[model samples]
Target: MHAVLPVAKPIRELHDLRPSDLGPGILASTEPVVLRGLVAAWPMVAAACASADAADAYLRRFYRDATVNAMLGPPEIDGRFFYNENLDGFNFAPVRVRLDKVLDELGRYRGVEHQPAIYVGSTTIDTCLPGFHDENRIDLGGRDALGSIWIGNRTRIAAHYDLPDNLACVVAGRRRFTLFPPQQVSNLYIGPLDLTPAGQAISLVDFLQPDLERFPRFALAMEHALAVDLAPGDALFIPSMWWHHIQALEDFNVLVNYWWRQSPDYMDTPMNALMHALMSVRDLPPEQRKAWQALFRHYVFEADEDTFAHIPPAARRALAPMDGDSVRSIRAQLLKRMNR
Candidate 1:
């Protein structure tokens, strides 16, 4: 069961969640997790720079000097506007400057200096860059090679899932992210691959303003949506396939992130296929729609205790003792269906 909570600032504190706390079969909160003091020892923090100052400097550099490539996509139409679904291609360039130099310049406003930007790639960055865990620290942990940064002004990225799970760290300014569960593609009104309009670049959420009349279903989406404000040193982990909308809060806001897919293939398709099937088969069939609607109420909405009561001991044993193979197989199926 879900409770309606007033929207508030993102969580700034960090706490570990045991597997027990998460329970089984339930997903993590779709809301952003704020981890405070997570990056207290970061090189920038050691310089005693204000979050905004560090962010501004970092973002200015990223936007001004980073090399960027245009993302390609097919276009499509929704309600009225056409949308382009191109993803930006960028190259990550390693920085040769000292951290002290970068931090020092973070405080000053250098006017209109246009240095040729470097395109930074994701692979060069440290995987542990986003982790606050002691075991994942640099030297003892791993080094961050993330050399490039992305600076999109009014620009937007299309709706596509990332292979790597992303931990976005905001350094220079604030960004607003509109996210949807991977399962909500139908409700999202995704653009077509054949053709797309210009304004529908990265978001299905009407940015100009919500047209409640045309997109009434969006009201229901609001219930499922969560927004997070990212400040300096604050990082947000967007688990793979979770739809997201990212926007710069200021003209010079900058952010850096580390992305890597978990091993053995980080994808699922069967679940996606099942969802597609259900939407078409069950929802389209008026009679079955009502029946499955009740089923969803019992299992998802009401959480009826009787639903799993008949599980045999053998079945429970297998289900309870889940392993990597089971996870892989499930995810693989979901990924397969999604690609289709």
Candidate 2:
């Protein structure tokens, strides 16, 4: 039997929102907010509301025989995509298949008691469904957002954090989002950073049946959990680095999401620095590690004009304000050293 989890606090909701209401302030918010009926008027949502078959047909109209990457798992996995028992690999196998064929397979499994989990995740909307965005779209206030679509049947994604801010719109079926603040990282029992089911490291705790005995810290994380259910036409804004576990609640589900990073494109991902720190600092002797920590605090974490006040401006080549050129130079220098 699965252990019952504590009820999560409901997410804040904004009613009567329009596409234009997604301004800079909302996009920059650190908290998650639900925009009810934001995409409810979309034609795709109308088709989905009419029937699953109608929704499939509407999606087929835009699919130009494109092959998409899909994750397939047996009934035994119970639609939860995760690592196998050994944690060496994933429970589901990834396959490239026709988008229409996936829709057909989903249609075939309709109403079945125990259906296989079929998920087509993170497919670029413009690449696969060329003109779909023309009819159905959201304005992100000129932010260069990458639009992606997720099609699946009754699946649960492990709790994970993304570097980019997200605006997720539900076009078909219903989805439940369980969210935790970025500060809850220590309590989440995150899996191996280098080895992950998806691109990002995910929480090891299973939401459906949490093994609290093994992951006792998860109980503390649950205390800070906030959740919300989103139906067709509803949208949710998730800020960068907030951990979220998503479940496609119905048999047929389609979600369109846009991701945009607040930082410049030239800036390297912080994950690189984290990996480097693990190699260079984590295993250091205790006293040296403490000394390095103080150095990092002075130079990186709590850096300001005073940090380089002793040095001449011309001599502080790296310490001065950084730009595209300086970033490239630093990256090249790091690469040269690491390759040694």
Candidate 3:
């Protein structure tokens, strides 16, 4: 029945996250790591605020009356509202509102077959500038992908993972984020249609009051879970495959996030995937299952040089080469096959 979760390191400043500052071997592994100052510099924080301020002000005013839009629409099944999914172009929205006027207009709009609103606004860094700092706009090309804004009241985004590593900057008001690593997917109490729960409307479990009796595994999942309260000018980085649940704390909570793939052209490792297929999908008779599992453990996860020498130098060279473009092309080709 706890409203918030605990974090081992409670960070208030950004400089604390520098990899060099944290010491060696911190980010060297693929495990989830939290960096405090990765984007704590004044330039980055101010830029994020500038990117989201206008839209934040608008949502605070319009969505303040929780009763008005509480159940107005069905849940959004597509998991792109909170996380940016690059369908084609950047999914950024520019929403504007006059606070005072919205407060007066809330009650009259009830009793209508309220159209579920999934607001997607458009903005160019130059045109939507709100003076967050001296020189505000960020170059999306330099950073691999652009930044975006999300604003709402008591709004909730479902559990899902993104291919890219993410940086979320909260400019105005406070918000809570509940995160789970990918390995805990089995115990997450996932929702309907293989789509996100509530058509992706609500998080699978009520974040504030998780029912341990019904979902006992969630307690163990919490051992690896982390929660962060991103305030104005504070940002958080979420690595790939880290499941996260977000909730707006105030009437208008605004967030702008920057997303960059770990490697733009890198593809999933086929050797690992094929191994998984052999165990899970390729069907082994009962007796062979144990043997296959043991063989896989020894040759794959725990494999040494003896098992891998079968991979010729040419194929190994194709995986990651000194030439950047060659590696990128191989990565792209691999992605195409996976999608097919």
The clash numbers for all candidates, in the given order, read: 36, 1, 4
Kindly report which residue stretches of model 3 are placed more than 4 angstroms away from their true locations once superposed. 1-143, 192-194, 197-203, 264-307, 310-340
- Stronger candidate by TM-score (1 vs 2): 2
Q: TM-score for all predictions? A: 0.48, 0.97, 0.56
What is the model-wide C-alpha lDDT for candidate 3? Answer: 0.50
For candidate 2, write residues 1-340 as lDDT tens digits: 3466678899999999887678877899999999999998889999999999999999999989899999999999999999999988999999999999999999999889899999999999999999998989788989999999999999999999999999999999999999999999999999989888768999999888889889887888998999999999999999999999999998999999999999998999999999999999999999999999999999899999999999999899989988899999999999999999
On residues 203-293, what C-alpha lDDT tens digit does candidate 3 reach at each position? 3555556776776666666777777776665556676667887766554455666666645444453445755576475686878777877
Instruction: Compose the digit string of candidate 1's lDDT tens values, residues 1-340.
Output: 1334334234333544321232212123344455434444455433324645554443333222222232221121111122323423212223444332333332332322332222122322222122222222322013222322443222334344553456665655556666666766665555442233322223454543556565556556555665676654555666667777665554344455655444444335334545565556655668877887787677656764466668875665323434677777766775798789
Model 1 quality (TM-score): 0.48
Question: Clashing pairs in model 2?
Answer: 40-233
Predicted model with the maximum TM-score = 2
Q: On a 0 to 100 scale, what is the lDDT of residue 317 in model 3?
A: 60
Clashing residue pairs, backbone N/CA/C < 3 A, model 3: 14-37, 77-199, 93-121, 94-121
What are the lDDT scores of the predictions, listed in order?
A: 0.44, 0.93, 0.50
Flag regions of model 2 displaced more than 4 Å: 1-4
Misplaced by over 4 Å in model 1 are 1-32, 44-67, 70-148, 154-160, 193-203, 266-340
